[model samples]
Target: MTGACRRARELVSDACARWHLPELVAPASVVLTELVGNVVRHAGTPMQVTLTLRRPYLQVAVTDGSRRDIRPVPAPDVRAEGGRGLLLVRELARRWGIAPLGDGKVVWALLPAA
Candidate 1:
């Protein structure tokens, strides 16, 4: 999981640099880490992370090995130190959702390219 997060950051950083869009790296990196970490924790397997460039958006997808219902844990007490990952993604991403895959699912997010 940690390695996945690290690799995700590396890939995002490379994309940002190659695209000459350095400003998008931080939030994208955090979201990627959270999404990939969820895959490792809940899906019980390493996941695949991919990034795609589009006219006005960047698409990030993380495919996990479980089709378990993955939903955001809403309204945790502020003092609690975890479970806010998906909530953060919901708030930060322009758009996001989960799609069923064979024996698994892929969670995806779209962020503004502008």
Candidate 2:
């Protein structure tokens, strides 16, 4: 999980640098890290990460082999849900959500690039 997080951060840094949206690296890294961490902790299955640039927004997505409910913990006191990873994602990200993809699911966050 540690290695996966590191790699995901590196990829995020690369994407931000490539897109010339250096200001987004930090928040994007946090969002991506949280998304990946969710996959490692909850999904526990093979995952694929994607970083996409859409004008004023940067979308970080992680597709994992889990269809189970994965919701963002926007509120810090949501103990009945899970950890605060998604909480951080909610704070750093402009918007985030989870969606079913094939037999698995894809968790994503949109960070402002502008």
- lDDT per model vs. reference: 0.86, 0.86
* Tens digit per residue, CA lDDT, model 1, 56-76: 988889988897988665887
What root-mean-square deviation over C-alphas does model 1 reach? Answer: 1.2
TM-scores across all candidates? 0.93, 0.89
Model 2 / residue 106 / CA error / Å: 0.6
What is the Å distance of residue 24 in model 2 from its true position? Answer: 0.9
Which segments of model 2 are wrong by more than 4 Å? 71-74, 77-82
Candidate 2 clash total?
0
Candidate 1 has an lDDT of 0.86
Question: Compared with the true structure, what per-residue lDDT tens digits does model 2 show for residues 1-105?
Answer: 999999999999998889998898888888888888878887899999999999778989999998899653555665566577877887788888888978998
The Cα error of candidate 2 at residue 19, in Å, is 0.7
Candidate 2 residue-wise lDDT at 88: 85
CA lDDT, candidate 2, residue 82: 54
